[model samples]
Target: MTDEHAPATPATPAVPATPAELVRRFADRLADLGLTEAQAATRAGMSIAYLRRVLDLGCDFDRPALLRLAAVLGLEYQELVSGRPEERLHAAAPDADSAPLVGPPLLGELTVPECWTRLGPGGLGRLARTGPDGPVVRPVGYLVHDRTILYRTNPDGALAPDANREAAFEVDRTDPKLHEGWSVLMTGALEYVTDLALLAELPQPPAHGRWVRLTPGTVTGRTIRTASAR
Candidate 1:
């Protein structure tokens, strides 16, 4: 009798980027199509928990999962497999209106609800606060929960225990070609969320265990676009 072994699996078309980046791109694209994570997961034939696990670094996913994700998101499988930057996710209709602005571009206010919608649930944003050295700003990974901004930081980090201090958190999206984008600014006092029960209940990046909440005193935003752009 001859010894037999299974044939080697084919290698991935390209080196896979960090799962978080791939997942974020997927999520953002789906969001542009007005779909939520749960909806997308269901359509992709995967549990939300499994999707979240894939988004968390160190988790494993096979090519079948990748195929399902690409098909559900309407992405090209080859582009995804090769991690092509030119095929980066963008607004579903990148050039919906190509007409010139009737007047001039102007900054317009975005209502609180609009701001929250644009902020979504995940991504990086800037957190600005007053420090001993005056004002400081740092990039932070954040999630929106119950109209409040939440992020995790080391217990000893400067931003971790700022319980009564007012701070500003901002997130934005832009299109260089269109010269248009929107920004949301949230000003609030920081509050520590040390309750284990409460922490477990909130939606956040899986790798972050320590968290702080920003209870917004004011949620304001602005957008730069022509009236006809929409």
Candidate 2:
């Protein structure tokens, strides 16, 4: 007979709603493992600064570093990405009745037009530049205007590039469960947009102090998909 008075099993926590929440979960897991951030970073083969930035500032999500860190923390990659404990157990032991294993991922290059299509209407992307300390990469919201990239920032902010300075921008999306994604990169010169006439025609009014444009010298992209999906 089932004991109605028996203690109930705890419900599994819901998946993190955002990247910042995922980082917080990582912190909790780190504490559970009784390891400091420095120790975890060392075991994960990454710099403490980079780990701190990811954990503390919610900076760019570096996949390779995260995969290594997940392994170091004794968790599966999918579990780390999805915050689902069941995924870890499932990865550890597959059911014999389950479907056959998926093949390796296939990568293919994207043409210039295809790259633009992938970047349609723009959204959030990483802007890379050389700063006083070293290479700097930060996320910024952008829009594609007349085949050029436009983003706004404070005139004195770190994202503010000098006239015609060289920089790189990248945007990507992925599905951890499906293991498929695409990334588009733009290498170009960044300059201030001073054309009042052109600025007046923007779909949305400038929200920041200054508008900057990335005039691409080259555009490239790549897509990754599981062989089974092909």
Candidate 3:
């Protein structure tokens, strides 16, 4: 006999490898939705304590309960159980200007914190500087630590910026097929780091000697995406 208090069996979409995996994916999906556990449980017409027991303890949840949670998270019944999203990953951006266009683009800005989150550590970005000859831009590998940009170059090389000089650094990515892309620009005064203690903690490459830092005064970013994506 069916228990009248039990929820109806939700649509089974995909099965997860383990109960823990399913809970973790559900939590991630909830985070992506910007929902709290209580909020999600309330929306799914369940008690907070019971939801917590299931999610935190990795206890088995009935199919009906799973369906309600999936609906609340805006995920396919199976996707809620699977740790990975249904979307496929794409290249960061095209290599050259000659790359074919996918469609007309829509543009938007990313907040400073978001910009830093995207920049992360050890990625390629262009450093712009003003030289006696003229303005110049060159590609460099950069790391973001404590919200400061750090890079390495030969002290005598053109890649090295003079301390106290203003500079601009940029990084961007695009997905032509998805008609989506973003660009981040950081402007700051370059400071050659002299603190041995701090330098020792940073990434040390045997081939590179001089390590410099950019303390950004301005960080601005823009994103372009297809209308459908929003």
| Whole-model lDDT values for every prediction | 0.65, 0.68, 0.66
Q: Report clash pairs, candidate 3.
A: 14-78
> Candidate 2: which stretches are off by over 4 Å?
1-101, 203-208, 228-230
lDDT of 1 by residue, 1-230 (tens): 00011112223234455676676677676654445688768878889998776656422456677777777655555544444322222233346346455567767787777777667555678999988888888888776667888787776666765655789999887655445677888888887776788675554533644678888999898878543433
Ranking by TM-score: 1, 3, 2
Tens-digit per-residue lDDT, 1-230, candidate 2: 01121112244443432577667768876654435677678878879988866555432456678778777766656556666443433344334224333777678788888887667554678999887788889887776778999987787777787764689999987745434578889899888888999776443434566778999999998878653222
Give per-model CA RMSD: 14.0, 16.5, 14.4
Candidate 1, superposed: residue stretches over 4 Å from native: 1-24, 27-103, 201-209, 226-230
Question: Which pairs clash in model 1?
Answer: none
lDDT for 151 (candidate 3): 82
Q: Which candidate number maximizes TM-score?
A: 1
Task: Sort every candidate by lDDT, greatest first.
Answer: 2, 3, 1
- TM-scores of all predicted structures: 0.57, 0.53, 0.55
Winner of 1 and 3 under TM-score: 1
